[model samples]
Target chain A: MDGFIFSLIIGIFIGGVCGYLGTLMLSRKMALTAGPLGHLTLPGIALSLIYGFDVSLGAFPFVILGIFLIWLFETRTKLPMETLTAVVFASGVAIAFLFLPVEQAETALIGNITRVDIYGTIITSILCFLIFLIIRKNYHKMVLINISEDLAKASGINVRKNNLLYLFLIGILVSLGVRMVGGLLTAALFAIPAASSRNFSKNLFQYTNLSIFFGILSSLLGILIYKFTNLPAGPLIISVSSLIFLISVIFKR
Target chain B: MGKLKKQVLKMFAKDKKIILKVKNLTVKLDKEEIIKNLSFEVKEGQVLTILGPNGAGKTVLLKTLLGILPYNGKIEWKINVKIGYVPQRVPFVKQIPISVREFFLLKTTKEEAEKILDKIGFEKRILEKRLGDLSSGQFQRILVAWALVKNPNILLFDEPMTGIDVKGKETIYSLLLKLKKERNLTILLVTHDLNIVFKISDYVICLNKYCMCRGPPIKNVTPKTLQKLYGSKIKFYAHK
Candidate 1:
């Protein structure tokens, strides 16, 4: 596939996954945590540098581990979930700086979606679709789980297991999107579309459809701009998405 | 200690007719006793209104039964019933606008949700309006509809009438009574509205740190019983 087409496809997959995860984060009131999950990818990439492994593969474990640590600190400590996420994210940047050369670190920060392989993009698309299906099948249970932990248990939701599954899926999405979009702007991929879609749609199905549409449109526009203007892909995509959001808000009333 | 009671649960269970049975039940929140050694059972086609003063642990007791809080005791109840629960409060955010139908549809089918709204005497147009724009009474009614959509064999409501006006409360009570008769549902509702409870409840369980009084309403309810349940400072007036 051509570079622009490949980038747009990957963008749709990444954006869809991000938008899905973003809905949960928003509902759980844990949107801020997306920052740390995104930023923490730095250490994962840096660790790949030290260990001689695929940066994406190496970063996956660290991101998952970071999720676990985040969950632990969040549950056991008095600090808010957002504070823990920020601390971990900052620490990840520090750790990455200590290990990676300045040149690679800069590339990691800015992100280059053009570098993602066609095979990798296809794999992400399949995985994102699978995750979406699982969530759709269990929509009732997911809402029950989010509304009240206790009620979920009473209703036989297996709250702990479902929560772990959700976070793990999110971690995988974060690592994958980070590899393609760059860590700094990857979280925007998750939050912006989901937030905008929520304002427009009420039911979960409608919300999911609108979110996916917005995500794909933002990516296509971003990639188009990058192809024509040589601007960075991540920021371009996020900017377009943000503009859509602004327009939606303006006409919402 | 009260003997462990295994009464027949309502439609949710195989035996049918028993809602809940507790044996030596005790609940503590942050090391403070909320419900102390309480036991009771609610039968099918009946409403059991739990009456208590402020901070009397009525809410705590309901939460414990719903598996929200940890407690020490034996609770033998039907596990098969699809339980419908309405909490004391619904988090309202001005930014997130949800419609009455959208809210109920979160847990139930569209046809059933529409039926519930219709049964509540609301105009079909209410389904399309945003929840943020709803009056307090309308919001509570929608919450009830949400709970009703589940068609629960046993329904547990915690102050479902709070924030509702008198007319709204009357409509809710009448609707609940109709539902109870039609579905033979076992309802354990916690409310400070003793008059309404006295009128509709088949049984009343008055609690103050423990099960102070429990039996068929009026025939077993008295001011002395209220004093025992809530101390002499608090009193229970007869349902006129």
Candidate 2:
């Protein structure tokens, strides 16, 4: 009972952070970027296993590396973000499968969230919340450029500075989110609640706040459902968030 | 001779304040140059309207002037001068709900945004209305209000009246004249409305990948001049 309760608390913290990062991504319309960020953590996890380092530490640097590569890929080619996302995701999954030694690969692939200690959960929550604060406070400035870069620049908002800051924050958010929810399901936690609340909220701030509320509720309930029943935590959490999103859609003003 | 020289000097004296200047400006996309060595200077309190066809790089020039596009040029001025820009349209994506007042207040206070919105003839009720619900004309006015609230020294507008109704266009033109008179602002308006351009512009520049003709409006530079600048296929109607 104690273990399950502890896990639920960690899950809720992770969900809130993912919700915040997802809000930033949705507002920026960079949903495709979230995919590579989630998957690219796999190789890092595998490396950490082989070297006996904490998996997240290994995952952190590589995720930042992957972000720069994605930026470079975008600058070099005019390829659509969806295409890039698929390529990065496939590569990460393939590499993790090939390198992580057959015995451990299964747990690593599906994510061993049950094994995450309190320390890991605390670190993930802190990192995610910090990123949320950075993006949230500067959201007005970010939206200005997101709407129209030209208009923003003319109005004295620095476009390059904002872009770099946003990208860096995204790197940190994705790494922490993947650590908590597993790579494949992390994107869901990031997107679903935010996507659901979008119609109901009248402005950026409200949309983000509602998303966070939904995210925390879904995470707590999901863990509870999994603990009581034998159902998976990830899918349970996602289902709750998706249900909320559907409700928002049905009753959208 | 000394008296005559003094009089000539007085006649040639120009305003020391330079609102904006572009020298040897060149812009390219996919290796094709859009703005080729374009040069111009806008003085304080003057309106410079750029008139060109759809693909004549009119928007490109405006984007370059605002430093939006990557270009090769020497921009002599445009630092520390508060600038307001109104794009052709704001795309509705995400349905992010924001009232008209909150929208304008993205950069400033609600009180200041309301003051500008009032100047643009929007009522207080319009402040609480969702931006998505506003008509195209009303939305354009809101955009202008957003720019006006900045209290800008220079205003750059990209096809402000392109998709607006006739009444909206009239309101915008009159607003430009009023803004110039009231704020003493230097305005650079990009448009295809050559007739309207003549009506509100202090000077008109006919552009076709380059500056074809630039001078004060005159009846001498009639439809024939426009045809010569914008190709023989172009049509122009005289505005009373």
Interface CA RMSD of each prediction in angstroms:
3.5, 2.2
lDDT of 1 by residue, B11-106 (tens): 334645565677888998878998899987767767899998889889888888877789898876665557777778755333344566666666
lDDT of 1 at A6: 76
Chain B only: TM-score of model 1: 0.87
Question: Candidate 1: which docking quality band?
Answer: acceptable
lDDT of 2 by residue, A126-218 (tens): 766676677678887777776667777877788999988987876776665655556676678778877887778776667778888888999
DockQ of 2: 0.48
Candidate 2 Cα errors over 4 Å, as ranges: A50-52, A101-106, B1-14, B78-80, B92-95, B219-221
Residue A129, candidate 2: C-alpha displacement in angstroms: 3.0
lDDT of predicted model 2: 0.75
What DockQ results do all the predictions give, each relative to the true complex?
A: 0.32, 0.48
Docking class of 2: acceptable
Which pairs of residues have clashing backbones in candidate 1? B8-B18, B9-B17, B9-B18
Estimate the TM-score of every prediction.
Answer: 0.87, 0.90
TM-score for chain A, candidates 1 onward in order: 0.92, 0.89
